[model samples]
Target: METNHINQSPIDLESLISGLKTEDARNLKLMLNIQSMMWGIAAVYVFISALKFIMTTSWYDKLGGFLTLVAFVAFALLFRSYYKEYKTIDYGIPTIEMLKKAAIRYELFQWRGLYVLAPLLLEGIGLNLMMFDDFTNLEPLNRILFFQISYFFVMVIAFLVGYIIWKKRQKPLRDYALALLKEFQS
Candidate 1:
């Protein structure tokens, strides 16, 4: 075959990208869908719990419940947006564009992660408010210590679980997308 040095043929990107839209893609879509559903369920649960708290006469309880309700609802919306992003992925689009979207969407950490962090901070504040009236028998210092210790442990456990999930699931998919993007770009 003569090398057409002057009129080189364009790269056949379709064949190269065809493999990417298969198993991992399906799994990622499924994962996002499940995550969205779980968040929706969590939002509902929090909403119900908030309603219970709101029914009480205590102002602290009502405020705490409101914050918690807002946090969980935000979480549900955030995850839903993630699922919506997945839905927007068009395989028919250019491979590079598709990969770029996948890479950004699958990244465990990004500017958009602030959306997750904000709700978490709100939840923490709400929990503290809700629990402040509890364990009143303990000394003030002891109560503070108890709340801090328990909250720290719970947050640590939650962070570890989230990190594990990202590492096990999203990281690999993001890495794969980045690899393909890099390969094609170079």
Candidate 2:
């Protein structure tokens, strides 16, 4: 059985801030690591796509190769931005103004990161379409409809996954920011 300790003293703001800051620092480190892994994953994906394009004679294949590179680079830049923002967040002791700034930037990061995922998903779909010759047989109207439906579906899925990831990182950072802000205000 789990024993619960009941009546306790008031919340210790200093201790709470310290604990939140510690968690934020840990989560920030994990985000940096995730960013590094993404770079490798993007590199490998681009390399494989390049090889596939080189082996194919179709003009569509060449276009797919170019799209792959563009897509990876774009997402990589977004991940890099997240890394840079976290690196500069001043996770150490901060003044009230600093916490305010960090809070705004963290919120901005969450929104921008979410938007980036949809485009990345779209680019992947575009490249896949180029590689598949089945689409060539479809009429222009049908092709457009097919792409529209697929893009919308893929983007919705990507946004949901991206939002979860952003929240995982954002929550800890936001908590730390709020704790600091509250302490400063008090």
Candidate 3:
């Protein structure tokens, strides 16, 4: 009786490293595209606000200014958070690689939620405030306060949704990372 043997080769470390580098490059490109899209949205917002200011001479402009400032602050915070997370992953500290990946995923979810929620919240506030101009019976202060409250509620909901998504996505990644670490150690 004759038996045939099949030979399998192990994965090459250099090839693994090259593959990782390519993935990193792709991630960097994706991050750049996300950033560009964010900036483009911001630019459009600024242009629209500038047009509103040029055309209107009302207290609505004050509300617009406040909303714009809020947007800028939120964007700055989100961008900074994203940059920090990106740096953590890009630096590749082997000890914390899994943690960094987890952080990146969380940050991405948070930023995405904020990106969707911010404009919705802003539009809600803007519309509510605009109604005040036409509704002479409503006090300006009351309208502003109502808009703020509504905005806060929307933000809370957005964060909750993001957190739920993050929690769901995190489990598999955590398990995979733990398994990888265990295998490496053994």
Q: Which stretches of candidate 3 lie over 4 Å from their true place?
A: 1-9, 13-18, 90-131, 134-142, 166-186
Candidates ranked by TM-score: 1, 2, 3
* Decreasing lDDT order of the candidates: 1, 2, 3
Instruction: Estimate the TM-score for candidate 2.
Output: 0.55
Q: Clashing residue pairs, candidate 2?
A: none
What is the C-alpha lDDT profile of model 2 across 1-186, one tens digit per residue? 222222253676668889999998998888778877877787787787778777878766677667767777787777677667756656565577787876777673545657676657658656665746658788756876777677678878977886797689876787898898998788
**Would you estimate the TM-scores of all the predictions?**
0.65, 0.55, 0.54
Off by over 4 Å in 2: 1-47, 92-94, 108-125, 128-132, 161-186
Error of 1 at 40 (Å): 9.9
Candidate achieving higher TM-score, 1 or 3: 1
Give the 10-residue window scoring lowest on summed lDDT in candidate 1: 1-10
* Superior candidate under lDDT, 2 versus 3: 2
RMSD (Cα, Å) of candidate 1?
A: 8.6
